[model samples]
Target: MSPMTRRTYSFLRTSRFLRPHIIALNKPPFAIPAYQIRAMSSGNPTSKMLTANPLKQIFSQESRPAMGVWQMLPGANISRILARSGADWVMVDCEHGNINDAAMHEAVPAIAALGVSPIVRIPDLQPWMVKRALDSGAHGILAPLIRTVEDVKNLVTAAKFPPEGKRGFGSPIAMQNFNPMPTFTEYLQQANGSLLTMVQIETQEALNSVEEIALLVDVIFIGPFDLGNNIGHPIIEGKMDPELDEAIERILRAAVTAGKKCGIFCTDGEQAKQYADKGFHMISVATDYTLLGAAMADSLTIARGQGKQDKPVSY
Candidate 1:
């Protein structure tokens, strides 16, 4: 076997239970039945381009080039705002921020209308939660704190359907964008095909097992802040320590070896650039709350600079 390429699951290092599931793609009752269907975009009159689905289209090319912003506002509006801002994608921050399933119920659809993919960062690997987000019409899924091959396996099962994984089957509901009245099979092929899945490898354990984990995922969106915090450098935003830097390098290299795209979430332009140069193609530059806070701070500074403010500069 080659050094970097280990025939991809060549050795039976995984447990028997997992080995069965690992081969889910090739196994019975786990394969997604492929069907040739006419491609359909969301029925937005303004969107004339041909897209199978908004979310799946992002991964059409191997690069999956995108720049997203997380958490733009307090309510569901952030998704739409980020879309309007021309972001290719945006992740509703349920893992760290206060985005519950109910919140996603309201936010995801709104974001979709704005012509950008809305990915959800779920709190855990609960299949129901992942299924809930997908059922609720999520364009993509961003699972946080992925640490092992087991984690990847669970996510795969949760996110995909049979012959691939064990995602439940339901074609029409308020969840699948309520295609008014569509058959179950019709919804399955369209929605599942358009689904995009991504995972974060931020924790020390995840960083260590990232090579194997990367093999199980399509994209690697590194969480810099939480990763640094996990490594004892909390709140040292935009600062790079050698150990952390090396860890980040290892992650990127692993993604390359695993044939996956690498992405980083940072709240600064400089740090974004640093990771970009390090081979991160898809990245999120800031959060919803952070953008507002920074703009507020800028306003305050400018106001304070005005020596004699007769009244607040309101325009």
Candidate 2:
């Protein structure tokens, strides 16, 4: 029997009490109350409900940590390169990066083509921005400057679809990210729960409400640049400042307590490893621009040692 058939048979066989209420096995899955179905499955104890999104599956497994790249430049080439770089996901930055709507449209597919999840970081908590990101086939959203629980609630609504949220869905392109593409109804049914909502806790206001926000979103991401700046320490001498470390600890505690994944921005692999050691579920290891800059600088140094010095190339 197929998994669905097996589940159905198991539910009917084990849930003798539910048989009286359930019309028939031929009835649609939606016909049964969702809670009763959950109860039946929970009672069975052998079945597992899995998330369809590739990136989310990383967090679903406890031992596997998620490592991602920050896409600063626009286009499919950059996105494709990063996606195939063995990272669990890629964060296409629309907020800080030069990516616009046009670039995102092209970039998301390239990322998905590599079977990697594309997470878009929108500039603000605007619904239109969230809708545009989602419509472009993004698997998740990283919303910055989330200052309160209310902000998180609105962002969640914008990210999710009807019944659970108010996000309007008509994107034919969005399902392209799914492997063995699902029908629109199947996609809609899973979309609200599958897509991740990562809220950046950067400001003092956000830090204060970290516990509540942790309960609201899937991931609690710390924007070190903004967090340190707002905390009046500016992340000078790395993110090791006592005050900033305390704040990071606080946010980490909140997420751990709420049973949510925690993430943070890192400047390089070293910093990323440090945070990962500290138990961050997700880590943005490095950005395209930073990698490129370091590569070019190393190449120039190699050329200089070979006595092949020519005119310097300026950006």
Candidate 3:
């Protein structure tokens, strides 16, 4: 048998559940049982071999929306702290945050090692950016400012592997986060289905094609601030425009109709909870920089003998 086939056989042979099925069917190792494939593809929380992506596991197992935090700062130590703080996922914000390619590489494994799925928010829908984020061992890539169905298609093509997409692969460090990491062959076989492909609906053009775009990606994420600005209803003086609210609802409805997950960016727990209650699948509760500033400000206010008061700005 070829080395790749041999590796597959060896991996299957080690699985007590699969060994009997393989022998009974007299099938090639590549022909995994339908149930096993489902377990792997859907990230069965009970399946040891297929639980590499914590975000996927949470999506499969939990009824509540996956709560996430945005990482604007650029340290593996900071990433680790966020990962351990009860978040289901941590977004390494490469788009607008201080995180660059090198910092992304540093953050992914650190976050993943703590069992939190590290999602990288790339600056744009560029193929090279997708490759870099995925190759760094991220559980997902969130591309910002996607404006067309073709853009969604290109994003999917750049994120997936052969037959499904044209993404090229050769990352030696990609599987380092998984406990008892799978073989390279196993990682390659599962990465496409296991990793998330999220695209942002931030532009007016994107809002127009939201339904079609929703059908293409794993998650349809809303950038509330950008969406408002692009649609000529910019959130002014901390107030949400009714027209922006309508656009956000339209995007949510489109995602629901497409049977796809919808996500949104929120400034605080209260805002995140409101979106979660509206059936958003994923919600970013806060950003590192903003949270830090807010906390400091609150502490100072208390120190100065002023009782806690709500911050008016929403974005």
Runs in model 1 with CA error above 4 Å?
1-58, 62-64, 171-184, 190-193, 232-237, 306-315
Candidate 3: Cα lDDT at 296: 88
**Candidate order by lDDT, highest to lowest?**
3, 2, 1
- Clashes, model 3: 0
Models sorted by TM-score, best on top: 3, 2, 1
Q: After superposition, how far is residue 167 of candidate 1 from its true place, in Å?
A: 1.2
Q: Write the per-residue lDDT of candidate 3 for residues 76-183, one digit (tens) a residue.
A: 999988988899999999999998899999999999899888999998889999999988888899999888899989999999876578877556577676655665
Cα lDDT of candidate 2 equals 0.79
- List model 1 lDDT by residue over 1-315, tens digit each: 354344444442255643532332332222334541223213332221215245445555445457778863447666677778877777887888877777887787777767667778888888988988887777678898877778888998888765466878643332334322233443444444446678888888898788888887678888876787787765452356788778888989998898877888877556566666767778887778877766777778778895432332210
CA deviation > 4 Å runs, candidate 3:
1-50, 309-312
Candidate 2 vs candidate 3, lDDT winner: 3
| Candidate 1 Cα lDDT to native | 0.66
Give per-residue CA lDDT, model 2, range 52-116, as digits (tens): 47777777755757999999899899999899899889999999999999999998889988889
TM-score of 3: 0.84
**lDDT score at residue 277, model 1, on the 0-100 scale:** 70
Best by TM-score: 3
Candidate 2's TM-score: 0.81
